[model samples]
Target: MSFQQNLQSKLQGHLSQIDGRFANVKLLDQFETNTKLPRSYAVIGFVGFYLLLTFLNIGGIGQLLSNIAGFVIPGYLSLKALNTATKDDDEDLLIYWVVFAVLNIVEFWSKTILYWVPFYWLIKTGFLLYLSLPQFGGAKFIYYSFLKPVTDKHLFHESKPASKVN
Candidate 1:
């Protein structure tokens, strides 16, 4: 086979593998069927907690929660993704959360300007709601459209070895 044809065949195979891996990731369906608690209850609880953080202005509790939401939980989910054989919806969610967390951290560092913005907390809270609520499929969309392309390119590169000099 020509080099071009062989490379094209390999690329197609990799694309097929990625498609097969993500074919069964129905985020909304998984959220509906897999959880023991109702989705509304979870949403209410999260909103309530956020309200408390904002209204009461507790010491470091808000920061702690932000850390958990942005980093700890997402890191756990990413680890879970690595361990699972199927790489299900959680994997997609993790990608979204991790990217969001990184961006949030960058924003956090610029709190002086961000704090002056009107309804900043409200906007951030809404974004968090969209991310955590599987019904929105925000995470799934991000995973498939943005993260997957970049990640797949790196993955393909990593799988191939460098040529050795004679």
Candidate 2:
């Protein structure tokens, strides 16, 4: 067999495996069937969960919840976007997740400075809420207004087209 034939066979096998794995997953159906109620509940539940974590402040549990809120929530949302084949949604979630991850890294490096600020965790919790809640589009706005401009300038260097006078 030629190299091209072998490559085609491998590609077909990989695609079949992917199809088999996703055959049982019905994320899109679930999302379409009950959108509003689940989304609202998710937003409320996350808010309550964060509040509980903040108020309780138990030693290890607080840390665990913090990790879950910071990592797992966004990660799951991003994967859901991919699973549903929503390119725009996937991009938005990924951008938000990347920005949050970078901010967390910065916070780690500036722990001493942040520690002096009162209600730091509260502020962070609020920011996470803004990012995670799809009802607000806060993350999308922030990305386009702030991150996109900077990234566009540095990465693509594409100048904006001039506006024509009517």
Candidate 3:
């Protein structure tokens, strides 16, 4: 029932869960496989496309052009990640592509309609930014700060001492 005992109990439970999760697999084993050049190559791929787009002046192509480029950027990255066996890197890329593709399709088809407010573009931009930020690990930090303590306590209550048994 003491505070120290409660803390120890909680830590032990967490260690047990972590142990179970990684008992058969080493999460760090793949860390060494990521070489520098391949990583740089991925970056180069994005930069190349960006440079080409800048010179081609595709920005004037209107909504259809914007939609295609938006989807292509993430879509290309997603495929590249998969080809390289980068699961963690690909997760965000895949999600971004999906969102971009959907938005692109919707915008491309809805141009003729006039009911929607022009602020729809601003709203869409905000939603896209919100969705993409968490993939960079911001959400994990927020959740740990706000929910970890309460969750840790609920998932693991303090154990009674052997001497306390009747």
Candidate 4:
């Protein structure tokens, strides 16, 4: 298949998945019922909302919304993960929370300076999303690549061999 056809096929599959998710949502059901458009169009509405909050002359409101969203979406996901019978999902959530804690610590110290950079909140919110989203596998990658190594070295050292000669 040509690249364009491949891309279009992948996008169609993704849209169908998103539509299915929205169709299951009780709140969005009301909106979907009234429209001929598929429920996935709600994603476009959210994207517009996000862009308005992000780029408009809204002062600190954008930053506030970004922070709230960055927290709330993953917070809800973490709650869902906790309530599930399988504990397997907890590992990613735990790593995500750990990284969030480390992020906040650094942000607490550096925020004043960070805001001077363009779109600091937007960047931070995107980073948090990247860290939390399972599809990205970012939290797992970071934990194993960086955080786990340090902890294992300092906190979980191998037992020393018997010191005395046999």
Each prediction's RMSD to truth? 16.9, 18.1, 20.3, 4.3
lDDT of 2: 0.67
Candidates sorted by TM-score, best first: 4, 2, 1, 3
Window of ten residues with lowest summed lDDT in model 1: 157-166
Clashing pairs in 2: none
TM-scores of the candidates are 0.44, 0.56, 0.31, 0.77
Better of 1 and 2 by TM-score: 2
lDDT of 3 by residue, 80-135 (tens): 77788557766666545555555567667887532455434334434444444534
lDDT of 4 by residue, 1-66 (tens): 999999999998998998876666876777777886677787778877886776552867767866
Better of 1 and 4 by lDDT: 4
Write down the lDDT of every candidate, Cα atoms only.
Answer: 0.62, 0.67, 0.51, 0.78
Clashing pairs in 3: none
Best by lDDT: 4
Candidate 1 runs further than 4 Å off: 1-50, 71-84, 142-166
What ranges in model 3 sit over 4 Å off?
Answer: 1-60, 101-115, 119-166
Tell me the tens digit of each residue's lDDT in model 2 across 1-166: 9999999999767656654544454663464357743333444465687778764666635545655666777778777887785588877787778678766887889988545966566557667767866677777887788878988889776445633432
Q: Please give the distance, in angstroms, between residue 73's alpha carbon in candidate 2 and its true position after superposition.
A: 2.5
What is the Cα-based TM-score of model 4? 0.77
47-102: candidate 1 lDDT, tens digit per residue: 58776775444664554555455555556666767777885766666667666865
Model 2 segments more than 4 A misplaced: 1-50, 60-63, 155-166
Please identify which of the two predictions, 1 or 2, would achieve the higher lDDT against the true structure.
Answer: 2
